[model samples]
Target chain A: MTDRPKTIDEIDTPAVLIDLDRAEKNIARAQAAADAAGVKLRPHIKTHKLPFFAKKQVETGAAGITCQKIGEAEVMADAGLTDIFLPYNILGRQKLERLKALHGRVTLSVTADSATTIEGLAGTFRDAAHPLKVLIECDTGGGRCGVQSKEEALALARQIDAAPGLFFGGLMTFPAPGKAAQAEAWLAATRDLLAANGLACETITSGGTPDMWRKPEGQVVTEYRPGTYIYMDRYQIAKGAATLDDCAATVLATVVSRPTATRAILDAGSKALTSDTLGLPDYAELVGEAGARVIGLSEEHGKVELPAASRLKVGDRVRVLPDHICPVINLYDQVYLISGDRVVDILPVAARGKLT
Target chain B: MTDRPKTIDEIDTPAVLIDLDRAEKNIARAQAAADAAGVKLRPHIKTHKLPFFAKKQVETGAAGITCQKIGEAEVMADAGLTDIFLPYNILGRQKLERLKALHGRVTLSVTADSATTIEGLAGTFRDAAHPLKVLIECDTGGGRCGVQSKEEALALARQIDAAPGLFFGGLMTFPAPGKAAQAEAWLAATRDLLAANGLACETITSGGTPDMWRKPEGQVVTEYRPGTYIYMDRYQIAKGAATLDDCAATVLATVVSRPTATRAILDAGSKALTSDTLGLPDYAELVGEAGARVIGLSEEHGKVELPAASRLKVGDRVRVLPDHICPVINLYDQVYLISGDRVVDILPVAARGKLT
Candidate 1:
């Protein structure tokens, strides 16, 4: 994507604008690393969720896509991509019916940690021609969702094996940095246990942008699912995971209204950048240098605290690196794909705000 | 809307839910207060952009609706709302064109501060059948949008008066606490100026949930537009603007995984509750009774620092009051309308994520 020459007037204050060049480069770099590592790269589409971005990722060589919910998968599936993996527990009749319908339309894979989740999926897909491909989610140390222990993971895998409409597709874990090694160890042990039990956990999928770069080489993971790498956020940049140049997505906001000497407000606020400060230290900062701290954010007003020496004025255009790229993208209806100031194309955030 | 008795087993976690009784009561209360004051109560639909919510507000005696953007107004207009006020300085040809088109469908009123905004509106509606209803937006105290001084507001109002296709509607301000008196003073001066200039400032709309009840009786403002009053947030509750029972919306999240002795995690994170901590005090004490704070929040997990004597277990459901209710509501596709323990209906956030 080319950056269109965005005048201060052209772009909306506090809008998420994507640098097509950086996005393509980021995608290429991630794909190259996954290729070098000899693993299937299933880039998480939760970051962008735009059909155009998904198409770009697929064009650059991706195994499939990964989403957290049915809403996201539905958007991606509608975009013509057939294979998708929702690596989260899908419960409830509404979600299960949607999942079953999706499975009939496309190749769908899901993850489960509890028997209830498996039973829910089993009930929905019991009579379907295609079995629901499921990966037993492991708590490789993130402690969010997954079986806590290797034995527990194996037990769940066995349960999945016994289930009539479920296929034990793989093992998936969203690991934290300190626990990545432990997660890999647990995966290795679980893989060995599955082998000893004469059942194969073919695809070992592990991911999380924080643990993406430090992915264990000799781990049991056959596939890597990393989101946020496509648009490296403030958190990723602050954690030294990606460089400023690697940051693909930014809130192209203009200084809409400046009222005070010390404070300059941007059109973007919690609504634009969102309140997703996961790995990020601040709301958002200057792209290349430390310029401002988000002092406060109302629904539509982002109070930017600028240094005395900073050269920013009302109506000046600035690129804001969102704390978390996913939710920020989710808040906007459309994003401008810029290369060098020129907006080459505007793409809708199709799966944006789709929290079902 | 009634509460639906769906558990973590039934519905996916981290979804936004609306308590119908609370919501309807909130609407009725705001409307009643405004009615007693003899002011047209046009509640801001930005808090819950769902058509169902808007319909309920109208049914409960709200005069019209208020929105921040033309995109939102378009959504409301499409849902059969014939009267809408966009209380933001809408700049740009595309937005202006949409605004003009919407003027054809509904009674549209917009705000403007600079000559540029008024000029844009004038250009857009130059060929329209009726003059564009223009409000001279004044910055009473909350230095977000609007002109700074009453003199500046008068000058802008005069500019609107001279414009080909613009009519001076009234004065509008998004006031803070200390600024209410100042806003009233400004509105009085501006109203006098408009009357002297042979222009009728029919509707003097001033709003802020914190200062909603602090309006000077029978004085300057003719109308009030309060968005958060419909769905009081944690911030409003903390600020004594609302009570917990008055909070109409909350995220129905499950305790998906309990990770530590001191900390318990919820499925709702920044994606659900959002990073809008303006109303929240400390991270660790967010919604926790005294002492416990939200220690950390990842994209999908909210890490809570629990009280030592507390016994929060895995799979327990907790209602989290978002610091900012508007964006949190926008993040979900549907809001479960809860009455008690049963969900009467699921209201789609129809105008959700419309950040155009």
Candidate 2:
């Protein structure tokens, strides 16, 4: 505590550096895209896991903040963030109790892809004065959690509508990247099916950072949730959603060893940069170091493969653009918020490790 | 805090469960192995990251504990750990200052693979009353940080011996798994080379959980620093180090959504279980559910591919054996110490997220 770093250079190695100016531009850019599409922007806090950024997104015209877990939402709610949408099928009695308690403190909404999840939600909120908004999660194209078909989504929507102390808050789907048309069509058909069944679909939400800027021509999506847009990563850049300059967060590491002419070891590794390749060839891209990439990572050391002409040496500091920003942020307790080369503030990742 | 779980069944989802009985057995088994081999067991705390477990290992006859970073060692030192070995090429002035302060508090030894790291350490401890023990890290086929050759190791050893306020403490290498003979040969050759140069190498150390049980016939390694043995994971099982019954840590997750007949989504995902494949085909192997494997992971959900005959359903709890336990333990703040089905205590991961 006595030797807390002030400037970026003074901060310790393997620290997460959030470029404040770049992050502000990214936030404004995302909000502008959502506003232009006439869809509400609900930036997911799972990326930063910091209430400060979540508040910033909300201040930048985000309708609300989306959290992947109820624990994250609880942290946000503690920081006075209202209107949190947890688009996850939360189970278990312990979490439901927490969810119910959190529901009392904020305008909370959750998603369900199965009847069992809805049942648990209804059972917990049965005696509540306000009905819990439950959205039916649709698969669309992402083959993860969600109802397989629109009929299943409708059935879950009906289940939510009929259940005690539950409100059917339309549909939500984490669609596959670059498959927006198929997702829009599937969601629109589901919306029509619900409409024909005499159930009004109030809000249809679809989200993914890769497809955030690609507005649906069908105008079926009422809200958008983009988690990684605030701190664009190398994966986001590879996906063409952002450029390297748009990347707001980077790992600052020191070259501890140049064991080989072609290899330089960094103090940061999987523990600092994370081993999330995200389908990329390496762990991260070295900023300003052409042809130099983090090829391998042990828990505490990153193996950077330098180009033949590269002059990287021991004691040299380098900034790295991680493959994914969300998990990388989750690895740190606090991130150095820097404006250019000077660190303005240190933000604690309050919602980090909120798995449940 | 009011609803703290008393039992494993009552505990919340996405929680790390450390089987106390199995962990005890693991500690005793590793200690006995080291005792039989006539080598000092310096268990690496990077696996468990808990001082309680580190103390358990030391109490069970470990010589000391090894930490990957100074920050981790600082946590262990603050927890009253006396002798600490940090097998990392620590660079930067801030970390060196912390290292010097930590050296003042405990018996600290660190490794350096290059002249730059050695220079930093020497510069920091130039006027200290007690000289700092510095080991030359040798590349024993691990392909990570270390001097490339025995000649280089001798050069660094001489440099450390000549440097003021620094003691040339033997050699250390994090060898590649299944290359024990090669690593031993390399370390022994370096030891001979140092002895020929009038430098008495005191302690030679080499470690990796995968090759922990394999005794070096050359007897060059005087101390063994094997992490991950405290809580054997699936990777250890695959490496033939331990069986499933020997695994002490398991992630307890709930089946939040059974959207498809073959796919069940668990509350635990990469954020809880981690995405470290370790060359394994899947994220994790399901406990007691044969043929079921965690196929994919999102930030908050794990997509488990269930066997056709499996009767897993939503709201049902499932235990998962992570591929790698070290990083998995880093993801949580605390883990439930369980004795059979009962939760004995909640051990805080005190050294977690100590990236610096």
lDDT against the true structure, each candidate:
0.77, 0.90
Each model's iRMS: 4.5, 1.2
Q: Which lDDT tens digits does candidate 1 get at residues B188-211?
A: 987887788777888899887877
Residues B52-136, candidate 2: write the lDDT tens digits: 9989999999999999888789899988899999988877777888889988999999898888888888899999889999998
lDDT of 2 by residue, A253-355 (tens): 9888898889988888888887788889899979999988999998888999999788998989999988998898999999999999988998888988987
Provide the lDDT at B137 for model 2.
Answer: 91
**Chain A TM-score for model 1, please?**
0.94
Worst 10 residues of 1 chain A by lDDT: A1-10
Native contacts, share recovered per candidate: 0.31, 0.83
Tell me the TM-score of model 2: 0.99
lDDT over C-alpha atoms for residue A186 of model 1: 85
